[model samples]
Target chain A: MAHDTIIAALKAKFAELVTTEFRDNFRVVVAPARLFDVLQSLKDEHGFNMLFELTAADYLKYPKATDRFGVVYGLLNMATGVRIFVKTWLNEPDLTLPSAFPLWKGADWLEREVYDMYGILFDGHPDLRRILMPEAFTSFPLRKDYPLRGRGERHNFAVITRAES
Target chain B: MPLEALPTLPEGPEKDYLWTLNFGPQHPATHTTLRLILTLDGETVVTAVPDIGFLHSGFEKLGEDLDFNQYVTIVDRMNYISPIMNEIAWHHTVEKLMGIELTPRCKYIRTILGELARISDHLLCAGAQALDLGAFTAFLYGFQQREVIYDIYETISGQRFHPSYTRVGGLLFDVTDQFIRKVRNFVKEFPKTHADMCRLLNRNRIFLERTQGIGVLSKELAIDLSCTGPLARSSGVVRDLRKDEPYLAYPDFQTAFKVVCAAEGDCYARYIVRMEEMIESLKIIDAAIENLPAGAVNVDVESKAVFPAQTSVYRSIESMIQHFELVMPNRQWTPPVDEVYGAIESPNGELGFYIVSDGTGVAYRARTRPPSYIHFAVFPYLIEGHQISDVVAVLGSLNIIAAELDR
Candidate 1:
């Protein structure tokens, strides 16, 4: 089957669930609330059995950005080799999305990573502890609000002094 | 306080008991500072808790600060051993998101270089695995070939480990015929060296006894944990990103290779899979070189997708402004604000780039789905019933590099 036909079938199947469609590359952006069910349906009915990736986005510079944070999921069909992108937008104040760990076991670490960097909460994740950062890390460094140099020269000097002591 | 006078409780029978031991966070066999606190019943392991994050560098956060062009260097640092593959995977992903297709020549060059990286990675893993199993001679032999491959990499990228050779739109520069000739020579000689290494370890009774049925991961467990690259392939999983989803010159090349798997799904299977993969990678490099195309290495200067050259910026004020705006740390180059998850078959399984572009010059979120991280998650499970000595052997066979895992 052609890539376009597969996408067309998906659009037809989940037309009601999706808010916007980026048809050129088979990406469908659904509302955050409906993302979990949509993903479950895609996996059970549509055969996108492999949850390839689950990552987050910080949209600090977009004009039509309804929410400042967006979470993206990539699913793949092992048999057919077709990839589908599912996206859901999250409001800046509370960056939380429904967890997909129950559906795909691989989402365990991926969700933890999203939580670690973007400070997004994966509701219902069994062990959603920080995967890549120190336990005492105070801030989500991936957030746009966090400066690259971090609290500036004073923080660096303080850290150096503390280390020496 | 004499023990004989103080307490004399009558004992009917003395029992021989097993003791538990913890290895790692500093053990040489854990490979990459992974702390595996193990509860051992004497030599056999009862339970293992793999505590990671000893090498986390917060690569995801670093991506937010660096521009699209500079971010390739960051990805290059993820899997330091196979830096070229990481950089190329990220490059292809960014190019896909921006909808900029490179010239055929660039695609061929990437294919060749990626194959070379695969060979180097497999050699390192194979050698390291042998070393962990007490086959020191095999390790030296593997490193001998790896050193030659590194020299080839240095000639192309000018960096020993982290080359950052792959650019967002294309390669850093074009490869000369001399480099191609050297690669061809390496291809011809690599098979004999590989055969010698295999003879040194493959059928050795000691190596087989140590690895054959150790750390067995069934096909179902492998799939559940989402193991990629050699780990998944060894368990009879037919999922190669290059073969399944062709991105660069992989589709153009015509090559035949088997996905090596063992029904046993043990540490031995993983070792065989990697050793066989090195041979297959050599085949791919040969095919890519034979069918190498001739054209401009990068897209034209007028292409709006890639950042324009400095000469174009100097000649045209509009170009200068666009370049400056695109490269600015604060101002991001918008590229449709969509998200793309591009994966390539790296030497260590599926190295995927889950890029969330908010239509900005800087990636909103660049998440690397490294295979090593997933393999590490299942490490404790694999080592549960194994002995303390076999823990090092099992960990070495998994080939978990801390940089990629913690990144």
Candidate 2:
């Protein structure tokens, strides 16, 4: 069947997915349950070859937010010059989603970054470790509830003066 | 042990089969703030684990707190070599999110500065790579070119190193006639330096031997690993965002525009790609400077969210208030709660910003898809089967900026 746009083709392929457009970008909001399948299909079938970026946002304090987290996947079809954001949401007590590393090896570090910042877990990821923060860090700094100044984590480090050294 | 002969690899017990070497968080070759844990079987690397994030200042976190104009200062430090490029990319994303249209003059001016930044950044990367490979004179040659470029930046932004020169709707200030003359002079004089530096390294047998087959990244792996810019171009990717995306004034470049590519996906190919790209950038700057559009450099934006240039503030009373509003760091405009991902072909690669707004001037979430961050990840793969010395070649070829990686 012929489709007008990639969004239409995707919508026809997946029944549960909803598509929204913002500033010429087609954002496909997919459910967390079938994210891996959707991403794999997008790569293999739809030619969305590049997983350009993967990140998550905390909507814990958002006025109209329905979910606690919004994981965004920046994808690009280099051949067609069509770019998209494959979005999926997760709530508190269950902030886990399927990893896109299988589709793109580049997702390795990006997923780790998302994990470090927002404390979101990526299922089936080979090495999902804290990327930008210390491994011992207990809190996710990017979440809205996390204070800008940090919660005494900065003060916890032992101070060593130049005179002592 | 024989005193006269070179030491040989010891044939020893189990532990000798695989040895781990810690390379940098402070090592000279790493350019500092980037650490690598290498699992070595004798001299051949079995694996290279990049332990990074020494300079993680939470740039994304700061983006949520700082207003649009205030944020440029922070982004300026992300890619310090091409600080102006970061400013341009930040505002490019900001303007796209806020639906602000730039003036014709503003676009041309930004394009000129962006290309200048590309040349400046490539010079440093090529210089530092040569410096790592022990070609000191070539490094000096590249640095001399950079010093001239820095003078141009210093003249425009009032700060040499971190020129937070770009503002939301336009620039911090309009370019002076002297600034235009300096850029023109740089364009005229840079070729001799470039040719000299190329001669110093390109044909030098030792440099060629060290870099030719070292750290070969296949074109497939380049794409799969999300490598961009010269790294991908060198690997025969045939992709340049200038032609593909055509942001700024790249599409209107008067000179013969072409994406420089190489069939060989090695350190040598990457070197050649950067060398060719610097020439392309100079051509772009020449075209832009000659045919710069005549108009107000700042967009005639009425929105309180966008700031006017210093020239506008001096001439108009209304613009003066807008300047203070931007400077004071107050939330002045209500934008529709939406998200946008805007990117530009920066010197390093596809420098992009994914911004989410929550009906306020401050970003709800600001995510940076920096090139260095991905290139750093791809380092281990490129160096897996190479010798210890090849690590420097691969790492240098990648040009992973430490600040951008952690941020």
Candidate 3:
């Protein structure tokens, strides 16, 4: 299968950096430190040309969890139309992961969004500012600890009037 | 927060001539609520930083609280221009997560409706682009045809805007003969308006001058920024999910129509690509209608995935129990504990849902990868060297709806 070849290639190249498995397609688990290297290899060597999606998931109460947060990287090989997910977990005190901006320019906003939602820091990102939320906002809304209704953040905004303008 | 946070222009010899100009969150050029902090030297835009989230409603958070079927309503607001496509995309993901294969009739009906959504979406994009460029007549022509498409939607779903028609394994109801006739009439009549709009703008001297080379996005940059749909196709990235990864009944009509692409990678290229796509959509709709099979619109009510019919629920205890089990919050259907990312070729681009289920009716995490969000991010790069007046032309061509962009 196509996944088998990808797994074999990843295993042969970055055996120490990542652990590969099959879920949906091929899924690779990389340590936070080795994430960039693994992603670079996948893009440069394996022809994973497109970064389909880059998102983060909070696993605070997950049954199977080694870390509190997981950063998922969805990569696509446009020629073969095969997709693989590369994920890395961030522990309690250190919630930072390497940025994939160098590999794919698409990572600029995707990483910024992850930083916005989960408070997960992306080291070496050019602009790691809040994208969806306002600049003054402090809370990370997507984290498990964050409340759904929000902690009075919505009510804090001062509505401007025509007189003020 | 004060305006103190605004970054001042770098002090240099040229800094005296450069000034910051604000474009929308209110202006018509943006098409929707979007703010752009544009730095311009005279009329040339030095940089354009898109400020979004004016319409962010946190749909992803709502997705976590709602069940698979219940969340369909939330996605309906994601892309308000063509709400049915969002509903279909959301349910398509849920069905895939639960490993539910739709009936042949359901698949065929979904394909037809999905193509219709694409036509309406492209029509609005093309019409709005022309409208922004002062071609008001072409916009009127395109919108008139869009109204007919909406009429067909109203006939089938009853609600024109937010038609929550697609269910997990099937459609809400079977199409009536009248609905089929209206759609047939729409496909037959839509081409005239489509052709008229093409003639009005495609070769017009003024339209060509304004759009031909404005906002040119290279194929590499398009892929680097993860652009899709017409935006990517116009830039020579030949990736179409319908052709590459066929879902529903798309594979059935692979040769009926070809994917439209242009190598120019400009606003005109995008406009032409969208215009050509409407024709392809009409072709797909015609094929689907001709080969429409006779069967049940939905799967068996006994399957528990869908609610039981009112007649059955009133007459039998078994059906009544099934309805209560489905409608009750505590006893709703539970998907297996797993994570899956399902994507579809939305009119905008690749609209994908990344779902994490915890073996409950509700989701652990539901993330929507909106195409507009990614496409809008590349705005600063695309408009960097262009004239300020050309901004609206490019913005209209991108067709970034604020609800989808910020959501």
Candidate 4:
């Protein structure tokens, strides 16, 4: 009941900028620039208080579309107990999107993680450093283009052994 | 009070104004490779920054190479404390992506095993919390009960830890009467030792003094940080996935269990919530066992989603061919081109899997939203104003498992 209302509201508010799908729950595809506005409205107006999850998917070789990357945000309306997904598409060359930290505090680390794994820059993130990967590591291992066995980074670690101390 | 508003003390004789202290990349209180950089003025902590990622094994990258069932072994290593919960959550995500609903018998069995995992997880947390606070007796009592749970796990899955017993459509094997009896016996005999352990630490004056107001996470901050499981509930968040978004057999036994909450939002409150949750898990386990469903545990064999039974594979040529077809990649089953998120109310918190299937045998993306990662993120915020001595108390209450955190 509440999900339909929220879905309808999201569709109405983001009219041309967003398209909606309902699989197990509402899934909205929004333009990358308009993601901040759409998510702001969802948080302020639609009562989706918690930004439960944020993840990225690489569709580089999939038969889907022109976009190579998709960033997903799982929003939950605690009052309604319904989860809705907001996704924004990004392609190569310049993959940057607005951060959701201003809307939810949980987005702070989630955005950092997205930046870490997918190398997608967030415009206004306070501290957009790598959260999971080491600081000296250059490659984003989660990217589809990245090899699973890695490019010798794992084996390149310098052995630091105690000698005569 | 705001962090900036905290009173700054002047430098004293033969002492610096402020200095950095590293708690660990290896320390007893950390229990794992969690390095906390703390700025200390005398004994008071000015700021604390947690540096993680010492255990990142590139599990998500590995998931891209392995198919759904093969990835189960990897998930088992993520939340190694209660590995079975990870198995259930991983397969639950894959099944959701593939649009498969498990049988009633399978759901009930999964629910029972899940609660057993929760009991073991909470018992370990409670025990370790007390041990960190210098009460060794409580830890021993708690591990004794955990061993009982491990016995039940061994009976069902042939292993104590990292069982990898759950399958996409069902479990690896049906619940034997021996497994049921072992579980029943564990549930029947655990409460007395649990009560004794609780009495040993719950009301102890030293514990209360050390933890009552130390590292308090306010309700607003808890929700903002996406803290779940007992951590959020202890802060009076009143949100539990098992209750709010019922999965497995949680819906059937909805009224049989209680979601415990404590408004204190301190180490003591988290201890109370975890202690009560173990009792609640026992109740759910009792109800599930009493009303255990009958019929086949695995889904229809004709579906070919899982391996054919061993007897059938040995008897019939057709069954052997079916097994080979299922195992071989050339004739591997194709999943749909869609994405689905499956989450379960794990012992520590909400463990979710966001799976993307691009009409392939392997998942295009398998993202695990480990609760430990999110819960640990809020740690530096919670520990800023606490004394140096209270650091272990706060860290223990948070239950930051490095395997889950790094994965």
Candidate 5:
């Protein structure tokens, strides 16, 4: 099937679910709350079986943006080669979204990664532990509030004393 | 239900049971700083738990602090061996979002560089796999070829490893005729050298015994796991981001390549797929070089987002401002408040960037979906029934680069 036809059918079927559409590339941004239902429909009914990639973004710089955090999911149809982008928005206080692990097993680590960096909680994630950050890590490094230079340096007394003494 | 009521095995006559062994965070075979706690019953693995993230550097967060152009440097470090593909992918994504298209010349140059990076990556995989299987000569041969490619890279972009040559609108500068001539010469001789390496190791009895019929991954499992690149191709899945999703100069080039696969989906199949892919990449590089065109390398070099040339900065006031804006940290180059997922075909597999721009000088969030991380996740399951020595063989065959996996 043509990519346009697939997009048109998706818009017709889930008109209420899609919040915004980037018409140039046929990418539709959907609300985070309704992502699971729409993703399941796309997988089972629409044949968008492959979970190509799952990624996230922070929206702290945009004034009046709907959500402070955005999670993007790239889905692909292996047989037809059609790709679609599914997005979900989250506020700073509660960076949580529905988990797609039950639908696509590939989401297991990808979700944990989002949690580790963006501090977004994927509700119902099986192993919702830090995949990249150490367990002792206190702050989410990907957040806009985190300093770019990183944590302030601790005093290197051993080296300093060797030079002085 | 009482605990004291449970039956216990007799002391001396009881058979010794399975044991659990933690194999990483420092193990040589786990590749990066991955920790695998393995439960073993005699020589067979009962369950394998992979603990990762010892090498995570919070690259995503750093992306949030840098502008679009500066972010390119960070993307280059994601998969250090194959940095060009990541740079191109990020550039394409940003170009798509900004609605800018490159000229024919720029596209072809990007394709040639991408293919070169692919060759270098495949050489690392092939050489390292051979070394794991006790073939030292093959590793040296592969490294020698890679050294030549690295020299070619240095000639083009000063830097050997993290080149940062690709920008949002186009490349840093056009490839000189001399550089093109050098590339042409390299392509002419690469095939014979590659053939020699293949003959030396491909059919060797020891190499075959170690890799053949080991680490089998089925098509369904591969898809379920969302495997990409050669790993997915080796499992009989015909998918390539370049062919399926045309980007850069790939759409214009006429090249012959196959998505090599094997029904066995074992370690040997993966090895053969990469070996064959090196030849295909060489063909792509040849096509790109032969069809090189003449034009400006960058479309908007004077734009506010790009770094201005030194001559322009000295002569023109606008160029000076543009130069200052580019050089000053955290001053210019803010992205829009939208999110985009940029992906490209890296040698290991799919290297993707999930960028969230908050309409600030820095990105709000940047995440890299590295294929090596996913491949590493499935490693323990692949090595379940195999001997201890086969662990290194399987790890090498997977080509799980620590930088990308841990990042």
Candidate 6:
């Protein structure tokens, strides 16, 4: 069945928001500039209260990729059990986008994870530092270009001998 | 009142006395591998900063390198307490991506195992919660039953810990009648131990003192923070993916079970919710075993996503060729070049897998929405204004599996 209510609400409320074909759930693609506004609207008006998941997909090597990274925001309306994906594409070099932390408090760690893995920077994130990776590590491991077997940086750490301490 | 609303120490000479205490990447109460920097004013916590990623094995990055089948082994370590749930969640998403339907027997068998995994996980959480609260006997009561569930898993998959039995289309092997008989016996006898645990802890004054009104999370905060499964249910969020989304064979056992909840949202309430959930899981397992269908467990032979039987390979050339192609790299099925997000109601919460496919056996990007990763964030909010001792209570209540965080 076509999810006309949500589409109508989005079109009626925010005419500029671009929504794509409904697949597994309602999929919306909005510009990076309008992300904060759209997310706020979804949270306040549409009752998509929970930003349950936030992750970026590195589509650099994929033939069908339109952008270098696709940051997927998995939204859910708690009462209704409705889910939607709000996606914003970011190209290489300047991997900057508006952070959803201000909208949903749960987005704090998620945005940090996206930044840690994909090297995507979130603007206005309070503490957007490395979450899963070390703060000193330079390269983003989840990026398509990054090697699976990391570049032997661990070998540099001095091995602790019995007498070293 | 929720713990966060309590008065913070206003600025003055008193601010200098605020003790900065490091609570475990190795400490006992933390259950290891999760560190929390607690700013304390005497016994009451002022602000808590979480530092995780100690067990960071790079599982998600491994997903891209490992094809669909190889990835199951990685998911096992993510939520190591209940690996079968991870396996089911992984294959469930993969099947959704591949548009493969499981047979009736496969569905029923998965439902039984999934509920068993839920019970097994809840038992650990309950045991750990009691163990952390100084109730050693209660811990043993719940923990000993977990071994029986492990025995059940071993009967099916030949492994006690990380079964990794689930495959993309069906399973590693079809469960025998012996497996069904074992499951039947488990559900029958599990409740006696369940009652013993409930009688020991539910009314015990010390257990109530340690847990009740401690680590309180409000219903609004619970929903806003996207907490699910027992954590949200304990806070009166009343949202369970099993009831609402109804993936697997949960809908079939609708009359037999329910979404357990509690209004308290404290450590005690979380424990109670878990305790009640185990019973509900037993009800699901019992109902499923009773009405278990008799048929081939795997999908039709035409489906390429599943591993073929060895005898079938010996009997037919097509089976041998299919097995060879599936085992070999870059010679197997090609799923659609699309993205799909699918989640199951794991023992903790909404354990989800988001797979972005490039129309290859290997996923372009495989991300997991681990419940622990998000639930751990709520800790700083919950533990503030509560005593340092309540930290363990809160952490145990949330069941923050540290292995899930790094992924």
User: Which prediction has the highest DockQ against the true structure?
Assistant: 3
Query: Candidate 4 on B123-221: residue-level lDDT in tens?
Result: 889888999999999989989988888888888888887888998788899989998898889889989988998899878999899889888999888
Better of 1 and 2 by TM-score: 2
Rank by lDDT, descending? 4, 3, 6, 2, 1, 5
Off by over 4 Å in 6: A12-18, B1-11
Give the DockQ (C-alpha) for candidate 2. Answer: 0.54
Off by over 4 Å in 2: A1-4, A161-164, B1-16, B301-305, B308-330
- Fnat per candidate, as a fraction, reads 0.47, 0.74, 0.55, 0.59, 0.57, 0.71
TM-score of each: 0.88, 0.94, 0.96, 0.95, 0.89, 0.96
Ranking by DockQ: 3, 6, 2, 4, 5, 1
Better of 4 and 5 by DockQ: 4
Give TM-score, chain B, model 2.
0.93
Q: What lDDT would each prediction earn against the true structure?
A: 0.78, 0.85, 0.86, 0.87, 0.77, 0.86
TM-score of chain A of each: 0.81, 0.92, 0.89, 0.91, 0.83, 0.90
Tens digit per residue, CA lDDT, model 3, B60-82: 88898888788888899999888
User: Higher lDDT: candidate 1 or 6?
Assistant: 6
DockQ of 5: 0.42
Candidate 1 clashing pairs? B25-B35, B228-B349, B229-B349, B332-B361, B333-B361, B334-B359, B337-B359
TM-score of chain A of 5: 0.83
Summing lDDT over every window of 10 consecutive residues in candidate 5 chain B, give the lowest-scoring window. Answer: B1-10
RMSD of each: 6.1, 4.8, 2.0, 3.2, 4.6, 3.2
Tens digit of per-residue lDDT, candidate 1, span B1-407: 11221222333454234443556678767776787666666678777766677888778778866777798888888888888999888888888788888899899888888988888888888888889889898888888888888888888878877888877677777888877888988998899889999999989999999999998888777776777778877877877777777779888654645556566778999899888888877877888888788887878756655567668888999888767766676664567776666778888888887776766787777778888888888787788878888988889888899989998
lDDT per residue, candidate 6, A17-93, as tens digits? 77774246578888787888888888888889988989888888988567888888989987677888888888867
Q: Residues A76-129, candidate 2: write the lDDT tens digits.
A: 876776788889999989988988888899999999998989889999898877
| Model 5 Cα shift for residue B186 (angstroms) | 1.4
Model 1: DockQ vs. true structure: 0.32
DockQ for every model comes to: 0.32, 0.54, 0.57, 0.53, 0.42, 0.56
